[model samples]
Target: MRKITLTLVLILLLVQSLFSHLILQENTAISTTSQFDTGDTAWMLVATALVLLMTPGLGFFYGGMVGKKNVISTMMQSFMAMVIVTVLWVVIAFGLSFGPSLGGIIGNPAGYVFFQNVSVLTSWPLAPTIPFLLFALFQAKFAIITPALVTGAFAERIRFWAYLLFMVLFILFIYTPLAHCTWHPDGLLFQLGVLDFAGGTVVHMSAGWAALAGAIFLGKRRTPNTSPARITYVLLGTGLLWFGWFGFNAGSAMGANGIAVQALGTTTVAAAAASMAWVFLDKIWGHKPSAMGACIGSVVGLVAITPAAGYVSIPHAIFIGIFSSWVSNVMVSKFPKGKIDDALDVFSCHGVGGMTGMLLTGVFASKQVNPAVVDQGLIFGETTLFLHQLVALIGASVFAFTASWILFFVVNKITPLRVSQEKEELGLDLTQHGEFL
Candidate 1:
């Protein structure tokens, strides 16, 4: 009897060990599937901060270009954008971007309020190491700066209240849909294999075309003869913008990987090449290169590389930079013919540069750099990619321009789009704020 009891006890112990082993294997599999890494999380955190800095950098860039009288107002527009867009993004924009798909038109509203399905531990497919909230903030910066770009069109003219209303409507109706179409995983553009690695078409091109519409509707600044308030401020603003752009491009990689390194390298090279191209072009056309030329060239290059950063080779990036700068320069020179005084030349630098980059990307993308990219190459022989690129460029431009034009007209009809002529001469600082700098 004693022997039998001992044997039973040993059998029970063996069964318990077997169950423990199975549990251990299951846990290991779950951890491996999740696979969140420290390095990737750290990099995403830094990148998020970097993108946030670009808003103020843009503020300075736009602020410096406007007449001195409107400097404060220009700066205020950027500040307001940061605040207003952040609110909108948290409340609805984040949901519309990354929430469950709604037949590919927009994201579902289930997560619209944020911190619902999102938490410190929650991860997104876009950046698995980072919380969904972090990714949302990173994208919010893009949304903020885009509308700020439009302020250049009607600077020193539009009322603050009217501009605020326009931004709200624009964010909801225009920006959100474009973002959903281009960046969301199930987005039609993404499904169609349209690659906009960053925000070339979505951010820069959209804003540029909208600026054109605003300029047309608002009419020219009160005094077309006035010069920029402080060239020094413009130079300062330009430097900051150039510096912040590193994060803008590299951070798009969303991880600390070879792709991120490649993006950074290409972005730096493109900006340098374009700067030189602009300087040489200016010298060839007239005399010495101006600060304005250098600043504009750098920005154009940055804008151009935005979509192509991770997909193209370094050499291709250089070509894109030089080509985009030249195109933008030419466009700027002839902008007067259109006679729409886009005060800061958003259309020339962002609009033309973005369009040029998108087309050039089609020409330059290679399967050698990223074998996963399908329909690759233009010079190396794939024509389908080029055709797809053309379609994206045309589609984005047409839709953005047409929608913005109608929006501008509607806003103009309901409320005046520009400040009075007398107010313009005095400067926005005094007219709008009742305070002189």
Candidate 2:
């Protein structure tokens, strides 16, 4: 065990050293080209705070849903992401994402080392009304939350120390590259005309696929207790995620503008519609309407509209919410019989819902809402956007799944991922965290 741990650490250090000099290009920097707007800046500041809060909210959400013995361990996984991912972002993760382009696959590793050339005085061109530093921080909030989201799929079984190592590896390799491809200006997916209003492609889809990989790699829980610890916590988490989504989706506009307003509106309508739809679907399926059902449905709706919020209308968002909630609901219902165990249905709610949202965006998107939209959706008689989104869905999902699966597999070999059967019966709360309810 000691030898394997040492080997992993050494390999990590070697990779970090190699990456520092991977691709340095100073001449390709984007000059500050616009003045900052106080309103936009303030809105973004607030939005960043809101998004940051969602991570803790996610902890509560996951904590409540897991078995009592695993609750603390599950929530701690999210809290760790908030801490660890920020350190990585401040170091080099941010650069690998938003720094100068490298063949459209990644950013220059040396471009934003220690945020060298980045400053508060300058504005990010993509969001010219806000300081570059602010942009970086807002994006950091995103980097922090993604890995936390993946913790849901392998709640009780994972070893905490192994999980931490996996977080570092996953963030650097899987998450960073996906963010670069989807959000950076010169990225391959961006150049392909794939429109992700916020993170249907980057955040949700990537996290969703990675969650699937983790669940598959970790295998099913050894013991049988899978009941939720607290449904109220799920509701609270749902509310927080739903509320933070206004910032998550609208803040992507980077300014207090009509696009942000449109995103905010769509986000609201979608959650409402989806929650309503989910409850009724339960009724039709012979199950009584329940708070847990409503909460999960609402969140899936939020995930579904995240990619289309800036490009679609309220009515479109409603349709998206209704359809996506039903799809995820069906997945939750049927999956109990499946071999794969996605504990909290991360892949079902976020993965399938993200895919549903992305395809719906391709169908309903319009340049009228946000001129930055690459093109109109197929509803407006253009098929290019639809095709591009499909490519992005397949490409990003496959990349995340393949890379994460291999990473988990190798990491497990180095240090076991799933707890031993004895530890499994003991409960992670006591064994992992030395806590008990």
Candidate 3:
């Protein structure tokens, strides 16, 4: 009996040792899987900062175009988005945009509520070399700027409190669904293989359509159109926007790889080409080549190339720049001002430019540029990718415009969307915020 008991004790010790070894090995495997590349993490950090700068750049951009009385109000609208969206993202917006797919229509809000699984130890599936937390932060910058873009359409006439409510509703309903559909792996558009290198579709198109809805819903401003508040501010904003776009386009590559370099190159060339093209077009049309034209044109080019930045060659990017500039310039020059009051022509520059870029992406995308291109663009004699892109464009446009209009209507019911005629004539700065230039 003593010998049997001693044998049983030896067997139990052996089992415990094996179990401990297995646990250590499992922990090691998990650590290896979560290990992040220092280079990628560092680059993403810089890129997030770069993208954040674009909002202030955008604030200046929109602010300069409005009347002097509304300059602060216009800028405050853009600045406000940063604060509001940042808080919302930390709480639940990130989860709604990027959580586990809920049947591919939208992300499951419960998946990452309050950032449950988003941690330093976790890695996003697509951006495997970076911490999942970093990816979420980078995406938050994108969310911040989107609602800000819509402010340009209704600048100088919108009720401040009502506009704030609309921004929140738009993000919760309109923006999240579009983001989930376009970026998430299980998203309908992503699964359909529609490639938006950055945010040509997700950011520009949505903002553009929403701008149109706002312009139509609010009607024209009571005050007559006037010269920009400050051309110098517009120039400064353009410089900032051009500088920050490098991150906006290159960072979408999600790594410090050759693709990022290629995106940077295309972005630079596109903006330069577009700026010159706009000036030249103005000269051809018997109009003086104005500083404002150059600024607007460069922005349009940036908007057009966003979807194609990492997919097309530099030469193709130049064409996209010039073509999109021409299209937007014409739209701006000939816009039916009597029917619609798109202050600063947000729809012309962003909506039209984004559409032009999306179509051109279908025409110019090449597998040689990016391996992710399973179906080459139309130039490569393939129709499948282009067809899919067209379908996605139409689907995204209809959804954004209709949903945004409804949100506007809902917000209007809760609180008036447009300010009273007296407030409008008094200017948003003095009436809304009790300050003026």
1 against 2, candidate with superior lDDT: 2
Q: Over 4 Å off in model 1, which ranges?
A: 1-35
Mind giving the per-residue lDDT tens digits that candidate 2 earns over 153-205? 88889999899888988989988888998889899998898988888878888
Candidate 2 least-lDDT 10 residues: 19-28
**Each candidate: what lDDT?**
0.79, 0.88, 0.89
Q: Compare the candidates by TM-score and give the number of the best one.
A: 2
Over 4 Å off in model 2, which ranges? Answer: 1-34, 336-338
Per-residue lDDT of model 1, residues 246-317, tens digit only: 778888888788788888888898988898899999998895878878877888899999888888999999
Residue pairs in steric clash, candidate 3?
A: none
Q: For model 2, state the Cα shift of residue 30 in Å.
A: 9.7
Which predicted model would earn the best lDDT?
Answer: 3
Best-first order by TM-score? 2, 3, 1
Clashes of 2: 0
Q: Identify the superior model by lDDT, candidate 2 or candidate 3.
A: 3
Deviation in Å, model 2, residue 327 alpha carbon: 0.8
Better of 1 and 3 by TM-score: 3
All candidates: TM-score:
0.89, 0.93, 0.92
